[model samples]
Target: MCGRFALFTPVSELTNKVGAVMPEREIHPRYNVAPGTWVASIRQASEDSAPTLEEMWWGFRPSWAKGKGTQPINARVETVATNNYFKSAFAKHRCLVLADGWYEWIKNSSPKQPHYLCRRDREPLYFAAVYAERDDGGLGCAILTEQARGSAADVHDRMPLILDDDSLEHWLAPDLTHKETIHSMVRHIDAGLVEHWSVSTAVNKPSEGQGDELINPL
Candidate 1:
């Protein structure tokens, strides 16, 4: 699961990359964005124009799950297509959780080591996500996860479903309704396209790690 990730790219730059409008308010770069906090997401515009960037809560509390003990931050891709909690969103509320990179912990060793994973070419990483409007008039989202493959499995058993450029538009296609067709469009990052290195353990503490230094390789 993508418990923590970073997005230090400037809003202006993100707008250019996703063809979305910038938020009216300033967005400070966050090197460690965690669950229960606001995060940037890209969704199709209401007017059928370029997608728009939105600030949504990171945890997904289904409209029917009010007052539940713990909201979900990640949904399993294998079950999402049919799970009642996520199937509706999977059918209609698709989105992209924008990130420059994410953190995964290698737990085999004592004092698990943290790793920063991102595109080898350094482009933005777009995590496949689904969102729902809450009863309180706010949007919340959960990232999708699949069994880790290749080198990524060495760090963790699951990883966010990172989308490639070819899949972005298909993932966010607003009116698409054929479940099998949508499932066919899901894409995973080529293992060779990604790279990771050990990062500071300070990332273990969300408050202290939301800075550039947290991403520096150890």
Candidate 2:
């Protein structure tokens, strides 16, 4: 599951990259973004419309789930289409989560090692996700997860559903309705498109914010 990640790209750069207008708030760089925090997401205005960027909470909780428990941070792709928690969002509230990279923990006899995963060329990535709005007008999102591949598999069984530039239009296109078309769009990113390295566990804490020290090798 994509419980933690990073996004250091400036709002201007993110707007240019996604071809979407930015929100009014100033977004600070986050090297240790955790669940329950607000993050950037791109969503279509309506079925068959251009995408627009917005800030949303990282966890998803439908109105019926109020006073239940912790909101889900990740939604399993295998069950998203049929699961009650994700079906509505899957069909109508799809979104793109912008990130420079993400952190995954590798299990070992010792403490789990945190690995930073990003585009091999250091470009930003877009994770396919779904979201819902609360009765109070607050928004929440859940990162989609599928079986990991390539180097990321070494750390965990599942990874965020990432999209390529070519697929961005198709993924964001709201008119597409075939389940097969949607399933086909969900895929592990090319191994060559990403690089991974161990980083200090300082990122285990989200309050650290951005710093050279978080990316430093332990």
**What are the lDDT figures for the candidates, one per model?**
0.85, 0.80
Position 7, candidate 1: lDDT: 92
* lDDT comparing candidate 1 with the true structure: 0.85
Residues 43-132 of candidate 1 have per-residue lDDT tens digits of 884447778889989988766777573579999999987988888888888888989999999987657789998888998888999998
Query: How many pairs of residues collide in model 2?
Result: 0
Give the Cα-based TM-score of candidate 2 against the true structure. 0.90
At residue 61, what lDDT does model 2 achieve? 86
Model 2: how far residue 64 lies from native, Å: 3.7
> For candidate 2, lDDT tens digit of each residue in 9-66?
8767766755777777878888888898899888886764567888989988876677
Error of 1 at 175 (Å): 1.0
- Candidate 1 local Cα displacement, residue 9, angstroms: 1.5
Give per-residue lDDT, candidate 1, residue 180: 90
